[model samples]
Each structure stands twice: as C-alpha cells, then as structure tokens.
Target: MSALERLNGTRLTGTEEAFALHRRINRTATDYPRDSSVPALFAASAARHPDALAVVQDGRAYTYARLDRLSNGLARRMLAQGFTPGSTAGVCLTRSPELIVALLAVLKCGGVYVPFDAGWPDERLRGLLARADCRWVLTDRPEQLARRLGACRVLPVDEGVEECETAPGVEVGGDALAYVNFTSGSTGSPKGVAIRHRSIARLVLGARFARLEADSRLLQLAPVTFDAATFEIWGALLNGGTCVLYPEGLVRLSRLGRVIDDHRVTVVFLTTALFNAVIDEAPGALDGTETVLMGGELHSIPHVAAALRRYGPGRLVHVYGPTEATTFATYHRIDRLIPDSGLLPIGTPIQNTRLYVTDGTTLCEPGRTGEICLAGDGLSPGYLGMPELTAERFVDREIDGVGERLYRTGDHGTLLPDGSLVFQGREDDQVKINGFRIELGEVAHHLDRHPAVRRSHVTVSTERGERSLVAFVVADPSVTSASLRHHLRTLLPAYLVPARIHLCEALPLTATGKVDGRALLAAHDTHTPPPAAPAAQPVATRD
Candidate 1:
C-alpha cells in the first residue's frame, strides 16, 4: 500500500490500549526532579560525546568539549560580575553558535535566560527586557540591540575570550527555572512562559518520537526566541547529537536545501507555515533530510500530501503542542495522507505530560472537542508576575486519583477514537461580532486553503462600537479583494467571512516566521479602510 494509504487507514503500531504506551516510556521520574538543572543534562551529553560536534553555525562547528570549556569560562565570568543563582539574563542576538554558548553559560551559572526576539521593534524589545528584570544582555555588538537592552551589562561575543572549565563537578538540584520565553497573547499583550529544568528533560525523554544517536544532526530552523528553537537546541545537545543552526537567509527553499545538503542534516523541524512553503515551492530541495518534524500552527496539509507523494511517508512526522506544554506534547507519525482535507491527527501525548480534554473539570470522552489541560513537569510556572491571569488559566486538578496542577491551554481539541488528537482553534481566539463569536483562525484557515492563496491572516477590529473583519492574504497575483471575499462567503457563513480582503505578496512574520498578526492588524487604520489589494507588502521579511 502507498504510505498515504497506511497513514489514512491503518491502526498505529502496537495495540489500541488506553493507558498511552508512548507516555509510559517517556515519563519516568528520577530520585530528584529532572528539570531542576538543565546544565547537568548538558554535562551528561558532553561527557558521553565530549569530542562530538555540538553546535554548527555560520559554517563553524563547536564540539561538546569546546562547549563545556566555553560554558565554564562564561559561567565564572558571570559569577565574578556579582551574578547569583536564579538570576535572569537577556539573550538578544540572531541565531548563532555564540548564542548557544551564552545560553549554556547562563544555565551553568545557575541563572535563567530570557531569549528576546531580536527582530522585535525597539519598543517591544525594551518592554520585554524590562519585564524580564534582566541583569545583562548578550549581543553581537553595540548597535540597536545593545541600546535596546538598556542598562544591562552587554557582552560582545566577537571579542576573543578564554574558555572556562567546571570545578571537577558542580552540583545543583532539579527544581530551578530554565528559561522564560515571551510569546504573543490574544489581548494585544505578551506573556512569558516559564519552563523548568525538569520539564525540559521530561519533554525530550517523554517522547521517543525520534531515533537518538550521537551522529544525528538536528536542523535548527526556529529563531532563538521561540520555544521550537529551544527544543531544537537542547533536544540535540542533551542527546549526544549535534545541532545544525541554519544561518539567516538559509531559511528560504533553495537556500534551506543548500544548508541541508552542506551539513547533512539528519533531522529537520519546521513550523507548519515553513513546511508548506517548502513543499509548495521547492519539494525537490529536501534531498538529504531523513525526517521532517513539524508543529506551531497546523499546515494547509494538502502541502504535506504533496511532500509525501514526492518524498515517502517516512519523511513527515506531525508534532503538536503549545509553549504552555514545553516544546510539544503530541506526536503523529504520518504514514500516509487522507483524501479529504488531509488533516493529520496529532497522535498520543509525550512522556511525563498528561493531556486532558475536559468540558469543565471533568475529563472529556473520545471524539469530543473540549479545552485541553496539560499536567506534568512540562507545565510552565504560569505567566510571569500575572497571578490573577495565572490562577485563571493554570488550575489544580486530579486525574487518575493523583493530584497535580494542569495548565489550561486555552486551545480546543478533541481526542479521536484512535487516541490521536485533532486541534480546533483557540478558545479565546474567537472575536465577538453582533453578539456572535467568530473564529479568526477559521477564517484564515479557509482563506489559505484556497488554491491561489499562499498565506492569510484574519483580525477583527472595533471602531465606534462596531466590529469589522479584515483579512490579509497572499494569493495568485491576479486575485483581487472582491474575488477572495466572494470565495470566502461560499466557504464560511456570512458573519464568519471577512468584510475586507486585502491581498499582499506576503504577510509579515515574527522573528520566528509565525505570522505577525499584530503587524497585519496595524495596517488597518481607523481613518480609512485599506484596499482589499494592499499595494505595499509587509514591512519586514523574517528569516
């Protein structure tokens, strides 16, 4: 049978029991917490693969031995500067080998690092820096980034420095915070998701989703700021594997293919948007990749079908999770494509993470969509400094007769009879108009599914007490506002359809290549409506 046929119709490997076998293998607890100190995980990896390449960036590679040396020196220097354990530092640089060193250095020194999206505007950058209470900022040099980091100590990585070593063995327990990653919120605000050392270990250890070997090279495509990047960096480094951090423009199809061939990347992870881009535009570019891991927004899926036809089913593995549950909590090994919609099911939960589909406090039955609640060390410590907000979202719950706190993902999804999951949109991503709730993702999803549409975004606005639906999309050059609106009306209900359809060459994306909804929303000014066909493109092209 074709790979697509098996993925579409076959039962998963092993029996169809309910206890979640994948979860069993991944979530064993140690005598102490696993995440308490991630530096130790690094230590373990370094010890096993001391001479193996750890990080590769800009054509230069740093082996585990070098990483250990650099981390030690950086840690001591930080300690010399009066830095204490549990302190927070800011990391503001493009994805680079040096940035990887800096993160390890901070962790080794018993400090949590805040990786700011270097592509954020100066204003947004300043706000995140201030909120993190950062003691220092590391960057390439004294320019806009340095100025934006404010009064924090600035480290210029270009300057030559000595590599430091640990004092034989350094000890710290597992309850420490690893890092705080800031992400966009529904209410025009940003929230910092706090991950602990144990959670990181649990997440990686929890899922035997991929083969682990010292020679595996994970492609680092996500920006340093996003949680996806964190998974790429730590997942590879801690597993005695090498992390291949792709340079900036290399994110493009032709360029991305070049990087894969040049570095011989064994494992590659791309966001849904990126996966679609490569499949639709350059499916031939991925000649060297063995496995393609994906998440962070569901792809159009037809795109995945195309890739599967071109490259066998073994190449695609659909990954799903939010930052609230570490990098990812669900996995679907796509053996083949379905005829309708091609929606790949996000299969069973990962190790140590407990996922519950609940109507309220009660667990939901299979095939019912409900709020997704995650319980485990994988759950973050709630949004930073927002207790009220935290309390409302992160709740204490009892499952399987055990007590634990679960993070209310705010994401809605259903458990299939097969023990897989199908994601719906966010619970609050809905915008109310004329007393009716309209799902923005639903509109965007429909638009992008259109044959001509390359990408799309839908944002609602209220002016003078009236709500409006505006959409930005990249479609066939010939498509116009009227054509798209007419098409959307047929797919969605009148109320759910976009009122204004603006066409663009491409949509603005965050530093991580996730659509920058804020920027698209900003293009909608109150003075006058933007044309369904925007003449000017997005201000920035994110790598």
Candidate 2:
C-alpha cells in the first residue's frame, strides 16, 4: 500500500506506491519570507549598508544611500502624477542606469512595472502596452514613442526630477503585484505574467544557486526586459551587493571581457545561445568571473564541456526556469563533466521551490518522463487579466493530503534517481530561440494573415546545434520569401521573423487535415539548396 492509501481507506496499486516514493524524492521544503515586498527588502539592505556601492554603469557609481535617495525622489514625482499602488506602468528604456532607476522608482511608488524592449517595433510595443492596459509610460529615450501612446502619461527619468530625498510612505504587501513579464503567446499576442513581490524576493534573497553576497559584483548583461534581469538586478541590490551594468548596443566579446575585469564581477548569467558563442569565439571572456550561469534553451554539450575545461567545473552552473517562476527555479552546479555525458541535468530545486515530474494526474516514478511541474514561493500568481489561461496552466492538486498550486511548465523531463531532472523537450509547438520563448503557432498566425498568403506553417530547423525558424507558406506565385520576411519584420520582432521562408503550392497535411510538421521538414530536407558559408551573428543583442 502507498502513503496515500495508508492515510485513508483507499487501496493503492503499484504505480501509486511508486508515485508516493517519487514525491518524497523530489520534494524540497525550505523557508523563505512569505510577506515581503521588493522595495521593503531593498530599503532594509540600504539601511544596513548605506555606504556600499549599489550600482555602476557608464563610469558612474551610485552608493546605496544615493540610489535610495534618487529612486525616492522619482517615486514621489510619480505619486504626484496620480500613479497609485497596484497600477501598472510601461517602462520603455534601453539598459542603463536610468532604466534601473525607473524600475526601482515604480516599485517604490507601489506600482507594477511592465518592461518593454526599447528596440522593439513601434506596433509590437504598442500592442503589449494595450494588452497590459498601461496608462503611463516611463522612458529615457525617444519621448516621441511615449507621447504617441494616446492617453498615457510619459515620465522621463533622465531629465532629473524633484529632489525630494524622501521615500514614499505607501504600504505594499507580499501578495501585491510587482511586475508583468510578457512572453510569446500562441494566439498572435503576448501573455503578460503578473508576478508578485514575494515571488521575486524568493529568487534573490538567500538564493543558493549563485553567490549573492555583499562582496559579490554581478554583471548585468541581459536586457532589462528579459527575465534574467530579475536575477541580475535584485540579486545584487537586495543582497547588499553591486550591480555592474553593461553598456547599450550589441554585446561584443572583447568589451564583455573588459567589463568583467574592470568591475571585478563575480557572477554572470548568459543564455545558452550566447554562452555557446562566447565559448567558441572568446573562451577567456568569463575566466575572471566566479560563477557563470547559462540557461533559456537546451544547452549544447560541447559548449558545456568547453566552458568546464576553460573555467573549471566549480565555476560553471546550469540553471532552468520559466518567466512564471521568477528568474530561476533550479541550478545545477557542474562539479565535473563525464565524457559522453549526453546532456547535463537541470539539477535540484532552488531555495523555497518544488519540482515534480507528473503525467497530468500523479507524480511519475524515477526515470520516467512527464511534464515538469513547479510549485512554491518562486511561482507567479498567474497571467495578467487572463483568468481562463491562468486556470488551465496553473492548477491546484493534492498529494499526500496537502493541496498546493503547481504551474505545469509544458516542458517534458525525466527525474533521475538522485532527484535531478533531465530535460526531454517541450510538449507543444513553443520553442526557445536564442533564449526568447516563441510560439510557432504565433508565427504561422501572422504569416497566414498576409493578403497574398493562403495558409502557412512554421517550424524550427536546427543546424549544428543552432536553431532558426523556418516557414512553409502556400501563397501567390509572385510572393517571394524576401517580401514575406519584410511583412513579418513590420509586425514582429526580428527574432520572431523566420530566417528562411519557402513558397509551396500547398502545405503538407495529415489525415486529420492538420499541418504535418514532420512531413514539411522532410520535404525541405530532401530538396533544400546547398548550405552557404555561415556568417557571424550578433550574440548579445536580442535581435
């Protein structure tokens, strides 16, 4: 009989017994502050270390006291403009000291911060703002874009605000919404994930994955809009450490190496794609850093081995998590790389987090593949204003007589006997291209909308471990791939646009009349032109 059976009068089968054992093996119970906000935590850090360096960018360093004062002054100005607690503010700014200040100021004013990539197309950015129901936008550059947002107030933080030097007295709770992160949605829009202050607090404060100590200098290299920024920014600020911001524009390898050395940076995080590029191009870029984390897509084994050989296994850590689960949920510190180790495990749960491999009903036995389910303090409340989707993805379930809410990640993986997880693949059409989550369905939806195109199907093609989007479209004879590419560029970001578009008389379909993805790839592989010489692609820029 299983533990569940022992607790009640129900009989248990062999599978049920295995499920009970698997739960015991995977569950990690840890304590974290359940009632703390980001501002409250940052204030506590500032009060303790007033003279410590808080942020560094563009040859300027801001101390804890100075940063506190700067954000406080801006927060008061926002409050004067009627920005209230629980209200959302759109932040469209490049990665800079001003961007960090604007984010902190919004939290200080008790408003939810919604970040947008400043480089995104105007139409794409506007659509995100409308979806989040934004009424105010804070920007450091291109005030024209902010002004174009009708009925939305614009605040430019770089222009200097009133120097009140006093923090706002607004009270915010742990459960209060903090920020909204937009991810690729299958319905041709983006899904804004409404995260709470507690969720972020759980990620940075007392995290075991990375060394986030007062002496730790974290390199803020990821874009402000990326979820990795949550770990980079707050991991330093809330921990009495210093955040060293990389300059704007593409991330050149030589510049990154210089930044790490000059700032004495101790911690850094890179997407899998960027990490691979760094290893292949500039293997010594991260040699001075103590901890280097890589994630956001399936990591390449060769790159991992190369990194371990250069930096040693102790300094490299592999992390995994979705936007809904704050920044990172699990971290696998590479102790040593065994030859022919097919793939590295994502490792165990981080502080105050739980990971479960389930087959939609009960936990799977060790070594069995199932959907990766996450639960705990790191989990977000749900999608913003999307209760139906929230219900479908984030569900409540009972195990061992305890009810808990779990976020079904839709990522398939298998739990090893030692409790680490090995990622299999996604269960849906969603793919992570260069650390950006994208839905192939979303791409197809936009492609089919072209007036000259009748129907379309989008698929990902992986060559030499690098993945790019490929589209097959049934369109007019006169419509060329270049024209379709131009059309997508206007509607979507450069990353979302297919690298290659093929014109077809009709898309291959299955017996059920659905687009046959495997068949399309097969046909493309059979008649595809010879590969051209690979060109150097930008590694650091999201585009």
Candidate 3:
C-alpha cells in the first residue's frame, strides 16, 4: 500500500477510531476563499467596524477608520513616488501604530514589505537592505537612515503627513508577493523567505489555534521582523479584533500577568522557553489569557501538564512551523487528561497544509521515524535571490501518482500509531534559543572569520532546563572572548551570538581527523548549572 493509504487506514489503531481521527485532522482544510488577500480582507473589516478600536499602545488608540485613512494616505504617497506592484520597500521603525500603518501602506501600494529591526546593528541592517535590493525605506527618522544608507530614499512616516480619505487605486491579488522575512541560513548569511498573499490569507481565514474573532483581543507581542508577527498583526485586523501592542523593554513576568488581566486579552503566543519559565517562576501567570499559543522548540511536557492541571489543555495550543512555511503549518490542542511523561503529539496539519514523513524515497508508516516534509498553500515561493539554494531545499516528488512539491524541513520526527507526529531533534547543526532559530554553521563561520581565530565549533548545552550556545575555539594567544564577540556583533545578529566561548589549546579530534563535537562538549570548562530562572526577560518589543 502507498504511504497515504497506510496513513488513511486504521491498522495501527482501531479501524473506526483511526478513520474518525483522520476526519478530524482534515476538518479545518475547508471553505477557504482563493481570491481574498490580506489587505483586501482587512479593508472589508474596516468598512464594517469603522468606529471600533483597531489598535492600542501606550494609552493611545486608533479606530479602524483612522488607521485606514493613515495607511491610505501613505499608500497614495508611495504610488506617487513611482512605487509599483513588483517594487520592494523597507520599513524601519519602532513598535508603534506607525509600524502597522507602514505595513498596510506598502501592501496597498502593491509593493512587497520587508521589515527591519531598528535595534539591529547598522551593519547588519544595511546588509539586509542590500541583499533584499530595497532602495526605499519608510521611517520616522528619515534623515538618519538616508545618510546611513547612501543612494536610498527615506520617507518620513508621521501624523503630520497629509491624510487620504480615499483608497489607493491599485490591484493586489492573492498570488502576489507580500513580504520577505530573513532567517538564519547555513551559509553564515541570513536568507530571506518570500511569502505570498494567499499563504497568509489561508492561515488567518479559519485559524482555530488563536481563535481570533470580531470581538477577540490579542496582544501584539512578536517583533515585526519575525514571521510570528504576521499572525499577531493581520490575524486581528482581518478578523475585526482589537490588537493591543505590548510596551518595549524586557518583559517582567509579574507585569505581563497584570497586562493580561488589565487589557482583557483573549489570545497570546509565548515562546516555549518563556512558557516553561513562567510555569516555574510564576505559576498561574497566564491564567487570564483564554488561549495561549507556544512555538519555537518543543515544550516540557511536565510543565505543560502542570498548566493543564491548573488550567486546561484546551487553552494551550502547540503551534509548529518554520519561516519557510509562513508562520504555522500544524497545531495541536494538547489533551489535558493525558500524563505529562515522554513526548506529546504535534497534532495534524492546519488548514490547506499537509504533513508527510519520509525516509528519503518513500513515506514511513506509523511508529517509524523519518524526515518531516511539508506541502500545501502556506509554503513560501522560496528564498529570495538564491535560486540554487531554493531549488536544493524545495523539490517535487511523486506521491500516490500525484506530483507534489515539498519543502525538506531538515527536522526528523516519527508518526505515532495514533497518527500524530512526535518531533525529533534537527538532523543538522541548528538549535532554537528562546524561539530564535540559530545555525551553528553560521555562528562558526563568523567566528572563524576573525583574525585571531584558528578554528571554531559551536554546540548547544542544556543545563537546568535551559538551552544555550557554547562555542569551542582554538585561537591565537591574544584572542579573547570579548574580542571575538565584539567582532561577531558587527557581522551577525545579536540572537546568533554564542553564550559561552571556551578557549581551548585544541579541539578534540577523532581518528578520522574531524573535530569531535561530542568530546569537546563533554570536556567544556563549566560543569556548574545556570540559574534556575530564565536568562532573558520575556518583554515584547514594539518595533
């Protein structure tokens, strides 16, 4: 039998039970509109709820009508400046209402939006702009960005600009490119994942994980640069819900709990690291939130079990996806009644998405381990400007006599007898630190580029329920951790920097002359445990 046939059968589980579960898995993949786009859908909501509060931040609010006018005005200005359907624009601004305006404006102008983190080092920011071929930037501090990025036009985004009461006359379809998000790449440079309008529209239309509705209120906690922000921003606007922006600074647990109660936010997404810490540092921190979505690495089942005991698993959702899949591909509403030992299922595919577990050539049956590949509407077109790399990762294969294109996720997993996927670790040198994906090869490449560095091998160390990056380096006598970190900051983003730099006379080598990372990790200088508390604060930055 074919893999799909085996997957559709009930051989492992009861016949009736397996078929019933299969129907439930594919239930959400129905009734999605093919022609709707993000901007178009949001506009419809705006017309229906013109007077409703669309966004709130720092004691300020913007109604749907007002936000529409602001974005329309900016879109008109962009069109006047010759921005066209295929043009790409960069938006560098702090987290504020202006950020939302810029996003909608770019989409309304029929241009692709590329978000920039103002907190990033200028060199790294410039590298992104150059790599994306973005010649226009929208920012409040136009003078600073203009002088820094020579030969680029910087337009100021502020309330003082002219207001436009009418919509911009441009045609945007679901097939057009919407945004490009940069993620850690194996080549030491960040790669931009190009996503389309239909991908996001499909995610928001019948999304059950977040349960966004006309009256739902969500906290916009994700940074604009991350793909998760796509769900926070558009998920609310398109659903006619209110989006409350979280303030900047490291998020204190005590304060976050208060904000949830104060704002009456129904839905929120926290990184798995933060969720685990909150379960320890301050129990019941998320009690006020109706639905909590956790992503970026798997959760500790014990912590999840405790939360389920206190609250319920129906309120906790495990959302799984990579940037290449446009935010989320699969979701599971954890079963609260189950025991918290061992691994939990990743659940089934979300709307318009399909999961296939394969062993290179054929799909693996239940109870067997294989590489997890994704196929469906949410898949990104490919990485930007790297055709060869894109071709290597995304490929077409024949399954059940049908030609289907699949993205090789590089992560391994197994299909349980009951049909849910149990996530295994990555097949490559990639790790998720506090929900941020880091490529060890990228980190090592940057470290080895340093003048004093001879060779570097980076590995992950988990101690006391925490994961951290540890770099083992053989360097010159004058090389220091501070110096290497300083050089790395100029080249790589802050999240990619290693937490520990071990200076060794020589890295352990195997008989085959290859660096044995396992031996190096076993002999690392530190055996002491890090603090039981989380390393970074969970604060949500506005920009």
Question: Which scores greater on TM-score, model 1 or model 2?
Answer: 2
Shift in Å, residue 219, candidate 2: 1.0
State the lDDT of candidate 2 residue by residue for 1-543, as single tens digits.
644444453222237655665566546665667698889999988999999999998688888888888889899888987988778899877777777788999998889999976656677788888878888889876468655676678888783655556789998989998899988899888899988999988898778888898999999887767788899999999999999998755788888888899999999999998899889888788989999999999988888987887887688899999999998989899987656769699988888888878875657777889898888888988887789999899977665565567898999998777777889998689999878889998899889889999989898888777788889999988899888888887778777888788788887779998898788877775345423312212365221
Q: What is the total number of backbone clashes in candidate 3?
A: 3
In candidate 2, where is summed lDDT lowest over 10 consecutive residues? Answer: 529-538
Per-residue lDDT tens digits for candidate 3, residues 216-298, read 88888777887888988888998899888877646677777777778888998888887887887776668888898887886
TM-score for each candidate, following the candidate numbering: 0.75, 0.92, 0.91
Pairing residues by index, what is the TM-score of model 1? 0.75
Off by over 4 Å in 1: 1-36, 167-170, 430-543
- Measured on C-alpha atoms, candidate 3 has an lDDT of 0.80
Tell me the lDDT of model 1 at 229. Answer: 76
Report lDDT (CA) for all predictions. Answer: 0.70, 0.83, 0.80
Model 3 poorest ten-residue lDDT run: 534-543
lDDT of 2: 0.83
